[model samples]
Target: MKRGYTAKELSGKTGMPSTVRGVKARAARENWPGQRRSHSKAIEYSLDALPTETQIAIITAQSQSRSDFSDNKQCFPAKGKSPPFAATTLNDDQRLTMGARLSFVLEIERMTAEMTQKKAIATIVALSKEHRLDLFLHDRLVVANDRSTPTSTLSERTLKRWISTYREHGEVGLAPGRRRKNLTMPLWSTDFLRCYQRPTKPSVEASYMEFCEKYTSDQPSIHQVRRFLDKLSPEARNIGRHTAQQLKALQPFRRRTTKDLMPCDVFTADGHKFDAEIINPRTGKPYRPEATTVIDVATRKVVGISIGESESSIAVIDALRNAVQHGMFALLYVDNGSGFVNDTVREIVERLGGTLTHALPYNSQARGLIERAHKTIWVNAAKKLTSYIGADMDRQAGAKAFRISRKQIRENGGTTLIPSFETFMAGIEYEIETYNNAPHRGLTKVRDPITGKRRHLSPNEAWARAISTGWQAIIAPSDVLNDVMRPQVIRPTRRGEISWAGNKYFLDNLRDFHGADVRISYDLRDASKVWVRNLSGELIGEAHLDGNASPYMPKSMVEQAYRKREHGQIRRTLEKLRMLSDKNNHMSIVEHSSAPILDAARLAEAKRVAKALIDSEPTPFTLPPDPIAKYQLWQKLNADICNSLPLTKDEALWHSSYQTNMEFAAMRRMFEHIES
Candidate 1:
């Protein structure tokens, strides 16, 4: 016998094609033994391994066969042409059940191949009875008699039914159909649920009752309605019941980043009410003071702050000035507070080459950095105080125990518990200093090149670093700062003195500018001095309040004085009305009686009443002498001498008459004083 033969040799010996390609093709078509690679990397058949007779039979079979090399049993039929029935509809569990059913059916079919059908059935039943075929069962089959006990056995009828289902619809037909319930609800319940889920957020019970009244039938119980409502999502239930601001808090928002911003590039400002109470300097009452703060967005440093009774434009301006001392910022971001949105603030920002931007209404998140600072710095400091009224304080117990009213404290002489306004401000300043010196997590750590030591960056460190890098702060002059921050009013100066807020402001600088409109800027907190600015925005000089004017006068004293003068006029008018009434009564009696009853007693009584009224009237105070008035009189005289134009005969006569009338009026005033 020969060793393994190549395809060419085998083809030649079997009387097939002679060429290698033709022989290889014939060998492949015949499903012959596979070829193996030899040591020389040439293809060789292993037909020589088989017996000579067997090889001859294989060659004869290959030549006679007309099929392809691949086995027909290994190939699957194309889908949809002849697929396993309903296989696509079965899930994994159902498929496993169906597979087990098919396995058992196949076992029965195999057993029946060599036996009678009735005998096969009986054999399967016998095997099931002996528990030999239990492994092929879908699951543990329940026993019919004991219902609680489970066994791995199926009835003969069930086996027959499995076989029948397989024959009709393949494996999928063995899967149990899904069971469904015939659920029904009242019509009113459906309507109520519909209304309940709407964005209007109608009350569950109310909606249910309304549905019942409208439909007049099939109303479900209120408890049932509540149960349905409980099934709804909380977010859905709160839809229209919550405000837009509350909804915004629940919605997703993008966090802002200041990574690209440099120190002094932007600053955010906001006002916070200090959580603890301090004694008001002016009122001596314990009250929460408003703290206006400006924080650099990049460094998270409190650059400027002002403590005031309320948040006002002046407080905001003071904060800006403080922040500007460190460095002039490029932009200012603030909320839509009246203080932040005014013209003075806007002008100051523009003058410093910066822009002021207001955050969206009710959107504190836009200024979240500064808002967080308020809690981190001010609120934390407040927590240490006994007068803290923060939300974290216990309302029922802690508040009642710790919170003391201003009146109660004053009456009880309890000054030990509350700090004065100055002390509170000093505490705030210390907190700010500590905050600026503390390491900020938002700042990047840097290693000192000279010391080779790592240092955590703080607000103060960042500010210093920025300044060393050539950043310059645009600081306003002290005079300009005082002028711009204070409120300004255009008032004409008379006699080198301008009356403002019930006080006269006089300056030698205004001597030459009498009757000229000048801008007077005065601080709200201090009325001792006012700045006099020319029309061109130049600071001419400072004017001092009159020595007689009270230093502690209120800012609204101008309006108060006007009100007092009007009240005095009203009293005088009332007195004159009484006198006129008495005179009118006497004249009416005189006209009706033919004889004028000018009784001496009546005249004396009337005269006494008139003298008492005159004496009761308040005496007017003397105004201080004005040098500007004398200067104006001298200027008028000088102008008259320089005039060369001759007056007409009628003008000269009128001038003489005007002079004679002035002389006569002066003589009459002298005579009247002498008589009195």
Candidate 2:
């Protein structure tokens, strides 16, 4: 039975009468279900307080007793709408409760609510009938599976509308019928046709989006555009993994073909980093020093190589010299490493009369020929080299130890060791020679591509060509063949003495200098030798075997000097300097004018006086009257002649032959007659 309200609520609603007899008791007296306390109150105070509606509502609630509504479930379906498909029963809670995990339920239920009540039910029914429906992405359902879902399909229209709604009101569109879609306007038939005509490739889709962003001030949403594109063709759907791989594989992938490459025309030298280590005799340790090499393109050979502690200019020079042992080169290709870009390397190349060219930074393909050759060294020789257990210099040191140990074994035990620099160098030489001589599969010369016989060249042959070609090219004169290739060494002097190899010469008596200035004539081809001469054409010394030559000075520096001296430009420069010095009073000269002046004004006047003196007849030094006095005496007589005298060669020659001779003869006769 319904529980009756207490007196407090009864008094508040009805009046004192209703409070006295509890609303339930009043209801009973009023012929109501005294079960409804409110009905009793309404009758008790019909005029001032309780209304008829209030009484009716209270009685109605009380009439349906708690026993009659024993079950908590209501008559309406649990969540307002029935589940899709046949009536089903699952004791799952649709509404949220305290302490419940609501994340999954809220998301799924929200998705379900977003669907049109009819369409949402239809999707649920479809999903129930066909458990394999995979297109219920987020809140949208896939209508048709097999027959291409045309853009006209309601589901497509619904999705397009839903996306529009989502953009306008955010995720609120996912909360059932609160969504509104964009209005679709008719586009021109031509534009519609052109849109579908686009290539169905995914790249095209990406490029189209990129184009839109670039050309259109307002870019459309990519998700919407992608869905729109989905209606175009089956090919626009997606690309398969196998298809992508096939496209990538279709491109030629064989190591770049360098068949047309020839020897000496292009050469590459680089420092190769190695994974393994070699023995160093000096420190008794093993280290993997850089392997610097210069290879010939035509011969496919390692022309010059220097396995040094580092790739230094000296090392590069040494390697180049080795390559050019047989011939000179026209062009040298290299990378942009510090060792390659430095002045030292540039000087070396320029001095040798060779032009150095650099590959694009990070572009190894430009030097593919030599780069390919280096691969063999790693694969064939390096891989075979027993792992070096000691420091880079260990082999030499160990060898020494072995030698000493051998001797020690003879005397005492086999524990003695000898670590020396010479020993290490020798061991290095041995290893290098063995590796170079070992035949390589790639290096072996087979029949020429044209001849189609056995290989035509070997690595050694290529190497030999590197030296030979470089030598031949470099041996010519720089003017004729422009061979400026050479190396230089700097040597100190004792008393203004410079040495090359061993012998020393004094610069005091050198022909090119009065005292200590030693003039060296550089050789273009063989830069190692320079001629030393003095200012008086006397050879103070020949630099062939001189130890005074400086090795520190670059070959290019020496070559420049040689070239300048060869063309006599150096002498010209010196003369110009001297003239400038004299003009500035840094040098002194004797004054030839009648008077010398120190002041600027007086100096100008003195110059005019000197000019007048020069124009006058030369005076006899001994007994004749002073030229100035004689000029005063003869002024009248000579004035006319002086005025008419010619200044040019032709005019002077004409007067000297006839007119001047006649005048002089007449003067001589007149003087004779006067004297007589």
Candidate 3:
């Protein structure tokens, strides 16, 4: 209906640029349909004659340039204000795409403010057709890279839909809806997932088949089922299928922070069976020795280590003794093995003014630092040895490779490729020294504030730094160390002596403790001495082995000796009984069949025979009265005899023979001597 409008009339109606020359330039740039004459002629432009895109562009530019329509305060209608669409409606990348689309639409709205509703819609459509609005979605939307194919531009309908959404719920409403595939899981899907998540851990095809058997309808493809399972987090997928320990191994763990700890604050101890075989000192056989190591948590430094035939409470105590040499620690962290939970270890910790803590059962991960050290120091060193038995080694192959016969070794000059136990221990020691001196990633690099020198420290350096900063080691005295390190047993003292391990240890201080129970701490290797402490842990005194008791003898030997003595006594008693029985039998037989006169004569004959038998033997000479006085008189007589003369060799021999004969004759002539 409106064929033409003058520039001033159009400017007054739509609030566009007021000057005709400026309007002419804008229309020309947008390629709007218009007629221009000479300077004297009036230029006329028709609204219906212009192209749709150019008309919309001109209207949009005019609307945006006006001051009255610049603000966005009055865009929404007033009922209850509609809430903005949530970002949760889309995934991360989709949300970003939606945000970019909303920004584009808002810019179009700002530019097209003066256009009528229908014209603005037409302008948006025209912009979409020319691909002018598509640049705003650059990098935000995914597209095919083929340049031969036409660019995939947004549809006018889609653009209008976005505009309507932005108008309804502000910028957030432009976000796309939930993806079609993720809307709802199929009816059989839940059961299938349950099967997959069971402890038996059925495969995807297995679970799908089971689900089909149970439901008999609405079965999902195996690929679909696999996709569903793949979407779950590793932990969820493994929940019921894996053991708690296995799951924990897969999951991440928080590292312990040692910022507040000083050297000797905590010590972690663990026993590791060495990977290489060596001669067992006790058995003299090839064996894998268990080594117990104690490490300071703050420095990651190995404070002590003890290698033995096997891990035991005694071995743990020995390691603790070695660790105490470096410094006393406040806490001991160990696993719940029998060696760590014993009363001896607990008592030792208490005596050292510290606490012993056992890690959670079956959770070796808690002691990961020490475990890593085991791998670094011990396992690495073991790989160099010929008898390595690591996990990667095939069991049968490793056994064959390491097996060397005793005869073979002897033929080879009594030498074996395997290191001796002592050499193995020395190697371990060297590894520990290297580990302590090597730079550790756990320690922080720091600069000395006073010296302005930067230090990247090893474990030992860290420990030294801590010590220099006023950390004092709570070391036990030698006596106290000796007392705490040995194993303790409570035994009662008898007659001022305490018997331990078949050896009786006696001390004058034990006199007061006789018949009293005292705690005895003695080293198994040296039982010659034992430390006696009261029940209250007060040291009474050290006791040494009794003189009569052999320190080398063990309890079993002592018991054997006692049994032998009892057996000898029984044998002697039986011999005497047999001899007495024979004599009684002979007497009874002789007296059984005699008349009274004959019996009297026979008894008198028996008496005479007994007297004759008795007279045939030598009698014991009685000591003379006043033996000391007699001895003095004899000494004087002997002096007088010596002063009289010295005897010749033959004469001396004859004199000695005469003395022996007189003695023998006196014993033989007992009846004659008595009568005389």
Candidate 1, 1-676: lDDT as tens digits: 3346666445433355647787677667776576565554556667755446647855554442213112221112222222234667666766656666666666666665477545776776787677775543434333211233565556677777666555434556666554433345545545665555555667766777677777666566888767655655566456666666656667778888877778889999999989888777656767888999999998898988887778888788878877787777899999999889888899998977899988898787667788789988999988866677789977875556454554468577545356666456556766787899987877888886778988778888887877898866666677556655665779899877888866788888788998999998766456788888988888888899883356476768977998999878755655565458668777343346543344677556655776687777765532122323423433344465469655445444444443322223333344566779
Clashes of 2: 80
Error of 3 at 476 (Å): 0.7
Reference-based TM-score of each model: 0.47, 0.30, 0.57
Against the hidden true structure, what lDDT does model 3 obtain?
0.69
Summarize candidate 3's per-residue lDDT along 552-632 as a digit string, tens digits: 789899999999998786555444444455588773434664422234664465556555755777654332333234334
Task: For candidate 1, list the clashing residue pairs, or say none.
Answer: none
Model 3 residue 672 distance off true place after TM-score fit, in angstroms: 92
What TM value does model 1 have?
0.47
Report clashes for each candidate as comma-separated counts.
0, 80, 0
Model 2 residue runs over 4 Å out of place are 1-256, 273-288, 365-457, 461-676
State which candidate has the highest TM-score: 3
TM-score of 3: 0.57
lDDT of 2 by residue, 617-674 (tens): 5544321223233223344334546787534453334334432222233344445667
Model 2 scores what on Cα lDDT? 0.47
Candidate number that wins on TM-score, 1 or 2 = 1
